[model samples]
Target chain A: MHVPTPHTPLPRRPFDRSSFVLSATLAILAVLTIYGFTTFDTNGVDMDMALDMLGDNAKTLFFAPGLSNVTIEGLLKNLGVTVALGFLTTVLGAVIGMVFALASALNLAPVWLSVVVKAFTAVVRAIPTVLWVLIFAVSAGLGSVAAVLGMTFHSAGYLIKAYAESFEEVDAGSIEALKASGADWWQVVGQVFIPSSRAALMSWTFLRFEINFSTAIAMGAAAGAGGIGFDMFMASGFYLNLREMGAFTYAILIFAVLLEYVATKLHTKTMQG
Target chain B: MTILHVDNVRKTYGGNSYALDGVSFSVEKGEFVAIIGPSGAGKSTLLRCVNRLIFVTSGEVSVNGIAVTGLSNPSLRRLRRTIGMIFQHYNLVNRLTVLENVLHGRLGYKSTIAGTCGFYTASEKNRAYEILHAVGLHEHIYKRCDQLSGGQKQRVGIARALIQDPTLMLCDEPIASLDPSAAKIVMDTLRDINTRLGITVVANLHQVHVARDYATRIIGVNNGRVIYDGLPKDLTIDIIQKIYGSEAHDLILADGDTHGTH
Candidate 1:
């Protein structure tokens, strides 16, 4: 390998505590990743099955019997359910999170309260989303209601943390100026926080929507939420129909891509506006 | 009538040292008082305390003879509506239009729900535009603040303050961040507002010559206390030397040519 000329001395920078934490975290992750690779498991080798599914099975997966019926009815209905789950949960999370977000902002509310809220959300976020879904399933029994509530609960954690952080980014002077003008808390929030961080907050909400969408698909399959993902689960597991799985998978990919594209466009528009 | 009566006002930040140590001064209605000080001489802190932007540790700050120290938030807010303040950095919300920023001055007058819903009365909007026109920013009222030059931004700041229809205006280093010509324009606008509307004006200024030209009275501050307070003509070289110390030499160097041209 050709070695490039030794680089010149770079200007020194003061790495903050966060930077040090990030570096330490990355280093630990690298070590864990290397150890995992070394101890790699391919014990239950289904290499032939995987290869056969991707290659020979590709034709049957796409062109199996009842493909037309699956496309019109099965695909549309499940896709609708999956999309609704993502949409409703995200909207609910965003609205609920927004109320708590204001109370959670250090600038807006008391410091102890903000810190308590922030810590509580961090703990909620720490629990895995799948585990959250399963936990809800026990109480509510396996259904779409359980899935929606579970996903919303998890999403509230994400939105609250992100929204409060976004609120914090509003100029300190802006808040002070408003408060000095004799405007109360709600007026101050309406006039300053909403306007100052409008684009940023919108972008964050959209990002949360994107995340919840993917999680919703997973919930549909994992917890019997009756969406495209559940149909996908049935196609892959119970039916033994490879083509149905392929169709469902493609349907999901298309939907995800479209949603992402729309989000990007919307984010850009809001930021510029 | 004395519009401001700050009696032995002492303010300390979180640290033990006083930002304003037993500082006391009073301003009459329609008088332009220039607070001249060196950097970090607690000029900003003093002005902020006057408007109750920051709480005073243990002293009295009475605006229009109303004690500000013990007033509840609602009462303090009502008191603040009559006292307009502009900043060195022109604290206009950058994303909002010049018109929107100016309208913020009228927020204190509106009901909580009305302001929250941004339902400004039609007259309030008209008054905002009139103030913008007074500050020479009416043409650019639709433009967002971030798009404006520093001078234009200060114009928006002035308009925002003016739209409050204030009895007293507290300006903290209003010309500190502007170029010479822009500073001159902002100073002229402030002087006009003081003259035409008879609003009591107290501005912290760096350029001693500008203070001499615009301010009816000059108050020199150093080390968290007032060292001098008198008419601009009565502000002696000895007091300037005492207030600025060695830094007065640099002020002379910067002042002569700029002061002569205007």
Candidate 2:
């Protein structure tokens, strides 16, 4: 005699705190945006003239694209410089971040040391990368030095958090097994944690490299670090040449796509290995 | 000769509740002992205290005649190398090869730089191969641990522990997650290690019948205290009732023995 039990359903509440909060936040932002648009934003906007000029600029930027101020070789050389900047800062950040990450990982380091390292990295990460660059400009005199220092500092802060979390997420059971086998702290990290978290670490490092690449481009114009971004700045702002701006934009877009393809391939290979 | 001793071991969580309340036991060398209890009965805690993986709140634990409580960190690690531990989860590194994971057992004997560089000598590699062969995992030596089946993974775990050349082996629910057939193989392998290598084995087991079938001695626990400690044949229905309390009714022992009717 097999009998199925009757199902009794519980009453559902109409109110959900999380959804209500989200809706309320979006409503407030909508109201504030509407108020700003209606009140103070139209004084100097010149809607009709602005729309006409925007249409013209878009046409010239997209349809008639050719570099007049710089040769293809010069543009490529400048692009290489930007890439080198990104690579240098990424390597420096990875090395320095790894040390702090080890000190900050909960399972590996003392509680106090982990807390101190995490807090310091948190503060550094809170600051915008560009702001860090500007701050370093005061000391390093607005050249490649300032850009490299600022970018490395910010990248280290970002990667320290990423690397520490990956290390912390390594299976605790594996760590316990190693410890039971009499592995010391360094040995446990080397044998178990590093090997286990290698894929995550590599992915995070590549993600940071991508970020540093874009930052390097921005710093080229903003901090006088010579790269394609300096030439683009000249084409768009100083020279006001929309065609040259379009050409530079296309070059950057192609390179960005290639970088993504490479990163994806490397990630897949490492995961399989 | 006694190989492991737990003297009045007490473990408390958050200053109030006792996980293990003044538990005491001793095991002779080459004995296969299974500590059996329902979940939350301090079976795992007692096993951890033997190796000082988790410290005992009070009382002393001695392994091979050395007190485990007051040792410094380096000395504790030095003492740990002689002991091997296996977990219910088969805690081999999933991304690493079986050979690499087995060689991890030798990490305690190497310098930090050598270990970091993964400089295992040829003899160590040969020993790892032999252990893998013994565990029937030689065909999967180059396979990542994640690719192995549950039984194969547990065999890899056993091989890793054996490569330590340990005097005593501690297992925490070594088969709680396995299927019945896989569980049988793991238990059989553990019993073989006990008999063949003469390594003392202490395991926490949840299944009463499995414990009785494999272990030479059974120690039953309930509510943080040992209730029954004797030969498996001596664990009658009444003693099992005392050890398991109200839950004893659901248990069916091997050879058609159920609670209260035997």
Candidate 3:
């Protein structure tokens, strides 16, 4: 072994508090897991039959899936509806969120306003997207309108935090330069802040869009919002057609991959530009 | 004529101690005044105060014969349009193209709607291109600022400042971050601009010899106050000691030889 500092002894690391705590936690979890399985809670259960059914279900749902109950045209229309739901809510949320983000950023706004905006957005973010949708469902009556409003509300909360942090990460020198040039507040925001943080803003917005797309599908079934999620729910629950459910899942997966590809390309383009 | 004046300026960062204590100076038009000081000697603060970038705790900073303190937002902005500022870090928006960043100097003269929408007229663009060419950045105008070298970036900063058609330019440690070679280029460019364009230049500099070489007048600051203000030839060894304190020994030794022209 080639030791550069051969005269000096290699210092040995002392056992630290965090390592002890981590080991203790793992030991406790291991004991609890073993104890849980050894307690013999399987009473009157047929293991063989359960395992067989699991294998059969997996094979039926994934291996031999086909669209028997629904036509490709119907599936495509529902997919379009879901895509529209996500896109609309994301666009609306991003527009409004940018305003709030600028207000919340310390460099861009007054301290009092930034604090207030941050506190309000924090509360909004603490609530889950589904709960917000349900809350709006009470007023808007559990339709596409409620879904749109709820998703947009949650997305704005999420994006305000993301966008504000990105804006705050901008170089202080750049901000000072713009201010020194006698640029007004809006001028600084539009020219320097927006252009400087465009790539980050786009990256965050795309992440939110992906989240919204998935949530829109979930909202379709839960809130009776019309989309492909409702079709999946009907096929699985009312129709008990696992093959149709598989077809819908494949369609969603393809769309998601395409969305991600587009996002990555745009992100690179912005970063280069 | 006096193009810039600082009258009895005092600044404190919400503390009992002063960052700038009763400092005063005046600059004639077309003069290149270099302010040399140790770190934390409030050189940057004094430069910023002239533009009202950092408001002084108590002082009168007048530029182009207009008082800079206590003006309304609109009037303050109007006052700022006639003055340009350069920074040590260049401070060009990295993601923006060189042309776009240079044109930013016109933001002060534009309407809010026009500036926000980036609606620059043909003349404004032509002036930007002309300034870029003068700075030797015409070849890289369409390239993003982040792609440029430090020397190139600083030139872009100068072009941005010049496009304002400013009567005065404030440079805070303009070449402090550059190498010796690049520093020479920046200093030469500043001298040329002062002599040719007749714009008053006030720059905060860390190098004593550089100040002596380029400035028509040198202001030496120590402990947030002006200790020496005279022609560069009159800045004797005793004055350097008074301005730099114990740090003067190394400076005098290291600066014994003339700087390389390269």
TM-score per model (chain B): 0.95, 0.95, 0.96
Please give the DockQ score of every candidate, comma-separated.
Answer: 0.71, 0.74, 0.77
Q: Name the regions of candidate 1 deviating beyond 4 angstroms.
A: A1-54, A58-71, B258-262
Output candidate 2 Cα RMSD.
Answer: 3.2
Which wins on DockQ, candidate 1 or candidate 3? 3
> Native contacts recovered, in order, as a fraction for each?
0.57, 0.75, 0.67
Worst 10 residues of 2 chain A by lDDT: A2-11
The CAPRI classification for model 3 reads as medium
lDDT of 3 by residue, B46-83 (tens): 88888888889998998878998988999988888888
Candidate 1 docking category? medium
lDDT of each residue in A1-273, candidate 1, tens digit only: 985667967669976999899999999999999999998777786867878767877777666634433666768888988888888998999998999999999899999999899999998999987788888889998888788888898889999998899899888887787777777889999998999888888888888877877888888888888888887777778877776777777777888899889988988888777
Least accurate 10 contiguous residues by lDDT in model 1 chain A: A62-71
Candidate 1 lDDT by residue in tens digits, B84-140: 888888887899899999899888888898888788888888888888887888799
Q: Which stretches of candidate 2 lie over 4 Å from their true place?
A: A1-12, A31-49, B253-262
Worst 10 residues of 2 chain B by lDDT: B253-262
Task: Please compute and give the TM-score of the first chain of candidate 2 against the native first chain.
Answer: 0.92
lDDT of 3 by residue, A1-273 (tens): 975776888789997999999999999999999999899677788878989998998888888778977899999999999999999999999999998998999998899999999999999999999999999999999989899999999999999999999999998888788777778999888888888898999999999999999999999999989899999989988999988888899999999999999998998898777
Task: TM-score winner between 2 and 3, please give it.
Answer: 3
Clashes of 2: 0
Residues B1-262 of candidate 2 have per-residue lDDT tens digits of: 9999989999998768899998999999999999987778999989988878899899999999989999998889888988999999999899999999999889888888888767899999999999999988889999999999988888888898898889999999988888778888899999999999999999998778878888999999998999998999998989888887877767744323322211
In the range A1-273, model 2's lDDT, one tens digit per residue, is 975557756658789999999999999999999999788766778989999999999999988889898999998999999989999999999999999999999999999999999999999999998889899999889979999999999999999999999999999999999988888888888889899999999999999999999999999999988798888889978999999999888888898999899999989999999
